[model samples]
Target: MDRNLELMLKEQKTAFYIFDSAVLKKRIMHLRTRLPERLELCYAVKANPFITKEIENETERFEICSPGEYEICKALGIDSRKMVISGIYKTPEVIEGLVSDKDFCGIFTAESVRQYRLLCELSEKYGRKLKVLPRLTNDSQFGIDPEELENIIRERDSHPMIEIIGVQFFSGTQKTSLKKFRRELEMLDSFLEKLKSEFSFEAGELEYGTGFPVSYFRNESLDEDALLEGFSELINGLGFKGRIILEIGRSIAASCGKYYTHIVDIKSNKGINYALIDGGMHHLVYYGQQMAMKQPFLSVIGKDSIIPDKLWTVCGSLCSMNDIVVKQLPLPEIEVGDVLCFENAGAYCMTEGISLLLSRDLPAVYIIKENGELYRVRRTFETLALNMPKYERMD
Candidate 1:
């Protein structure tokens, strides 16, 4: 922990998230350098839209999964050419509006035939050629089937305004088996070869969503270097010669964020020490974590003193019993006003939590620049205003 950051945390009164811009950039650069050189990194904006601007220049492209994500980039004045419009349920109005824009040159991903037709109609109506990637799903509701995709490619001549640039496929996230991914890549390579042989259509790109796993538990140790090396070898051995776009999110942003919350109360119940914190389940989330049964990286920011460790079950301010942050962790002597800092919270924790449940106030957000200066980006927001509704006159 940096002394300056510790001093800044001591001055805070409420739970908040502090993002390190330097760490974010380093994570992006690490992926770029570690992965195969032929593979282009596409930062999934849904992972932490707040840091998109901080890493926009470091990544080759941005995977925009929804309208809100697109707005985030637009607000940040990100270049449209670097955007990859994606997601299964893309709003027709939003897609039309984006396609109708005069300067819109970003690529769009079609998950189904309906989306394909929507893009074609908009392309024809706007009198502009559109670049698209048809996503092939692994028997899920997310994307079109392989047969359906083949039909679309076979009839590509009918839609001159639409150009099928390549294929996109994403199974899921937090994957640990390299063998599973290898099979998927092999199947995809065979499909592309079939398309090239039958329709004489060579895909110019392949946007693969690498569901890279992020180690979030004490018992989990992922060999990230070995995984990346194996995946890179599998991709390089493929016969398809095209641009490779690896869509990543959680793995890149999780390490750059830290969640801070202070202990408000402490008590003993039935031979157990319970430490209550201002932040709870509504503010923190880790993939596949069940009831905080697994231990995550956390530390107590307090005065330097030698003290014996004791088992403490950390809970949150929420009224629900499920608001446990961690269960029975050994820690030094803790007192009220002692802040607990949680690491690797930069990904889905903020938005995935049930924020509006208890009408609790939202946490403040801060960013640490590369020069070690801290800046507050958002103040603690009141969610009661959003949860409450206007009273109606029944009389």
Candidate 2:
């Protein structure tokens, strides 16, 4: 066990998430070093926006989807130009805010023809010549249809403010196979070439939202070298150079987080031994509804002396019987006072947690620095009672 982890387990008895900023920085550096020089790495703010002051300089750009996400980026001191606004829904106020900022050079993706027109409308009204990227969402083609793309371009030409810079496409996620991504690059080439041949406007960038899979439960590691090499070959072979942006999320921050929960009870049911912890599915699963098949890597802190001979069914403190974290898991003798640590939880665990569910307290957040210093980001807060709201007029 890490010294900081052990200290945290000993001092902080409540459920908390420990984010290792060092690991996150290292992961980002590793990714940046491996990717082609032209490929710009933009951190998807939705993954883990909990940035520490010390590591704030490490991340340059962010991909935001909503006003809340944009606010998070602003809170992090990120420049407005470094945020690429994506997703389908954008409030008129948010659009106005994006267009009103004179220094905002960040890219916004339009998923539909309606969204593109909306951007043009807002930008023209504000008299801001904003750089816009067309996001492919034609489900049938897995990209923007050529006819619709031309229509959007024509509409933008009619309005002098908006300029079409590039295209953005996100087909699917959790990909590990290099061959699949190679095929995607090939298809991208075809699409780009088709756009060049069909349209008169010149596209300057190609932002491909892709990244390797993070090892949550299954440990078939991604071949990063092969993927980067293959991608480079594809880009160079095509001889189409403009700008490349790689939008990454979960994979970058997954390994940097750890969830700590204290075991409250140990019992035997039928033919299995159950170790119940204070944390539940709300902490382990993303949506706090479905059970994740990937068994989280656990550590029984300070209890490595005993040999593992028992198959214990580890469960959370939720009322539902389906709140099992892991079942039939081989572990050393788990006691009621033992601490259970779940690794690889940085990306989508805490934000997706149902803290108000069953009136449970929210988990505390801590950032473990590279020097083994634990910085408390957020202290655990108890949920308000369901009947505590006194503003009821229906009596």
Candidate 3:
């Protein structure tokens, strides 16, 4: 840790996550400079809504996935024109509210025929015009089938309040195969051409989820720059003359965050070393990791030395045997108060963890601003209240 960060963390006595806003902006700027300029960058707010305010101006649009995400963007005062409401399970109340509000000018994506129908009904009832993108499924429950999407396009003229602006598609994440991406793009291009030929429908935009891979394990070797280069080449070569939007989340936010936990106990069980940490599976999360079989990016902050001189199995405060952080990690002579720093934890780790399992206290969150000021966003919060119900009379 740097001296400035260490000074700030010295005052924090509990496990926490620290995010660097400068790093976040640098990552976004890197993508903007490397990728095709014609492609618009859409930051998926589901990844890390905490940093949305810091990145709102840097991205062309924000992909809101849920009511909470929308509320976060709205609270940040992000322009509605720079929002794309995209998700599989958009609630009726939320959609109705967005459509009824005359000031809400964001675009909406239809994941299913039911969603399309709901949008049509709400738009007609509220007398508000809506721009929609019908998502095509990649053999998943996330989007509408190609045939069903065609039917919607055919009947679009009947619903004058709804306009089919483009198509939305997203494959799974942790994509390492460039060939697979190219194939998907080719299929999408062909699909757009078919729509143009059959119904004279020209898509004004195409919102695609890149699902870029993040290297969480030490063994995983990924050439991200090469992949982005090839991805941009493929997108630029596409014959579609519509606005192309790349919805990304993990790759942009992962590098800006780090998780910190301190050891509370150390013991030797049956010739095996064990170090108990304050945080566990409920706080630290990494995609595509199983039982700590692979080593993640971690470092030990010790008083004397930061070198690794011993192998220890780190466990969380949870009572379950499955609450292991790492199987066997190389570490220096660690004491009870030594801290462990886990890197690349800025993405889904905050929200995806099984936090309410044992009703453990959620860690504090801090952000280092671009001007080199450390600010605490959230203090250590107790989750037992969320797990327990309020006292009420039995009816």
Candidate 4:
């Protein structure tokens, strides 16, 4: 814990997100060091948009799937050239801009033949060749049919503006099963073999979304090195020329951030103790893993921390009963004005949470540079309803 950071936390008037750039750099670098040279790494903007120049330099590209995400990258001044779009719905208007942008030079995922045709139309109109990766799924989710993909490959001569890189498959997210992902890779190998033998697909990139977690909790950390090493073994000597592209979201950013809010009230109902804070569930991140466990690394600031035998449930200020940060947590005695700091919150917390449900002010982000310099990058934003015309009542 940095003393300067503690001072800033105590001085803050509202809830805030604090990110340590040094931690983020270490996390990303640790993974990158073990990856093969042929691997291309991308950071998912939905995880966190606080992309420092150091992070920007480390990342090969970004995966953005929405216009709002595009706006976030634009606001952060991240290069649009390094972004690849992959979403269920690829609107013509958005795709047109992404392809025509002078800086745009990355691949885009076409999940269907309809989308492929749209890309062809746009590329021909713009006089450009669009690089594309066919999204593969089992028909329960977003992906082009395998037969549809093959038909397009067969008719490759018809669409010169679009270049088929390779098929992209997302096995599962937050999956720790090595056997499952290995099987997925093996399946992909066979798929690539058929494409290569029959359709002549070569040097196409496999956009693999790495769905591993960096921080489940402080006690249980995933052995990323071993997992990635296993991935290296699975892909080794598969006879595929295309590079493996990994899109990492929460793992790279989560450990670097901590969420803080001062306790406003303390009460007990029946046998359960509750500590209510100004910041509620809406302002905090709700990771599926963390939510399932109902336990994340939490620090009580401003005191030496006494270990009293009691369980405390931290609740947000929202009136909804579901507005809870932690259902039950064993902690020392906590009181009003004491800060509750949620650890491993650098990713998915603020940006992905339902900040608009109660219309609470969006939490501001304060960044501590890798050099230990601290400053605010973004201020809290008021709700959209607050700024809307109050004179006319629609309801």
lDDT of each residue in 1-395, candidate 3, tens digit only: 68656875687777899899999999988988889989888999999888888987898999999998999899989999999998899999988999989999999999999999999999889998899999999998899999999999888899999989999999989999999999999999999999999988999999999999999989788988999999989988899989999999999999999999989999999988999999998898899889877788998775435567888999999888999988888888888988889999999998898999889999998888999988888889999999998999999
Query: What TM-score does each of the candidates earn?
Result: 0.96, 0.90, 0.97, 0.91
**Residues 165-262 of candidate 1: C-alpha lDDT, one tens digit per residue:** 99999999999889998999999999999999999999999999989999988888899989988887898899998999899999899999999998
Instruction: Give the per-residue lDDT of model 2 (tens digit) for 18-89.
Output: 888889989888877776676777777777777534345665557888889887777767777777888767
User: Relative to the unseen true structure, what is the C-alpha lDDT of residue 95 in candidate 2, on a scale of 0 to 100?
Assistant: 76
For all candidates in order, the CA lDDT equals: 0.91, 0.75, 0.91, 0.78
RMSD of each: 1.8, 3.0, 1.4, 2.7
lDDT of 4: 0.78
Each prediction's number of clashing residue pairs: 0, 0, 0, 2
The superposed Cα distance between candidate 2 and the true structure at residue 267, in angstroms, equals 0.7
Alpha-carbon runs more than 4 Å astray in model 3: 1-4, 302-305
Worst 10 residues of 3 by lDDT: 300-309
- Of 2 and 3, the candidate ahead on TM-score is 3
lDDT string, candidate 4, 343-376, tens digits = 8888778877777776788877888887788888
